[model samples]
Target: MKLSTKELTESLRELILKGEFTSGEHMREIALAERFQVSRTPIRVALAANAKDGLLKYSRNRGYSVRSFDKRDIIDAFEMRSMLEGVASRVAAEQGMRLDAEQQARRACDVNDSLLLQNCEIDEASIEIWREQNQLFHSAILNQSGNRFMHEMMRIVQQIPAVYPPIIAPYRLQDLRLYNAQHRKILDCIIKRQGMRAEALMREHITGAGDIFCEAKPN
Candidate 1:
């Protein structure tokens, strides 16, 4: 099979998100090119693109390495996300004109319900599913805000190293359950047109997740 540079970039980005490639690890161009069965040109292009996306650090002479975010970076990222998202919620509410937003929010809630109903413990794959749905729900609300700056800021924040689901070896079912429950509550608030409540819930939800991520340190 063949892979495009964009596909290769996405594959490497996912590897970083899943913690397959740890921070400070150098990405050997030849090795990656050979492994992906592509030429070095695409590999270089992919690395450059990922670097621009803030997923990797590139130096003219030193090549590319995975960028690491410390605890403070994670906290700051969440803080910014919460503030922007809260504003987005308020804006959406004030406008009072978002049929598509309401639908997307409801669908996101339904997706979470399906996942939670499985009643299984949190695993890598399950966490990925939750992350995808959560992102969709948040994005839907932001899109409704009609603020291009807010959306662009969130797009950048989502690329941060610690923004994805934490890679805890012993997955915590309780944390997953609690987070999912919060998602349901937030959706309810949005559906009921309780804009302020929705904003507060989202802020707490993001900050709470940040706290949990910090506490669940790598083993």
Candidate 2:
């Protein structure tokens, strides 16, 4: 299928985060076009978009290459994201979530609950499904925050390596139910308008994920 520019960007970014492309490796438009089964135009635009997100470096003649980030860099970015997202949660709780946003979050949690019901075995397809729903839950909270700047900052921070929710593939094989539980608590806090508790829970949730990511990351 021909992917839109936004879809292409997201797909490429996810692959990059998953280590499909190594650090400092240059992405060739032709290769990506063939891989994604799309024309070079979308691939080109996607690469440029990722570059803007700081996931890739662009040079006049070098095109785009994956930017290398050590564990510290990733952890630091996640720290910032945690604080920003925590504030978002607090704001959303204080202001109250829209009916649609609350509904969307509940749906995402229910879908993930079903996914987590499987036995301890984890697969690529399952991970992909979980990632999608996880992103939906986070997006609902960010949107509900009613702060555009916070939302935009969360967007940029999440683009960092090992910081994006979809990058949780490394820890998925472990105790993902814990994360789901945290999600439920966060949702409950927002619904109950417990701003401080929601903020603290969100901070811990994000930092906990970061810790796991760093541990699993190769030295």
In order, candidate lDDTs are: 0.76, 0.85
RMSD of each: 2.8, 2.7
Q: What's the residue-level lDDT of 119 in candidate 1?
A: 59
Among all windows of 10 consecutive residues in model 2, the one with the lowest summed lDDT is 161-170
Instruction: Report clash pairs, candidate 1.
Output: none
TM-score, candidate number 2:
0.86
What's the TM-score of each model vs. the native? 0.84, 0.86
- Number of backbone collisions per candidate: 0, 0
- Return the top candidate by lDDT: 2
Evaluate residue 45 in candidate 2 and report its C-alpha lDDT on the 0 to 100 scale.
92
Q: Write the per-residue lDDT of candidate 1 for residues 63-111, one digit (tens) a residue.
A: 9998887767777887898888887776666667378777877787788
For candidate 1, the clash count comes to: 0
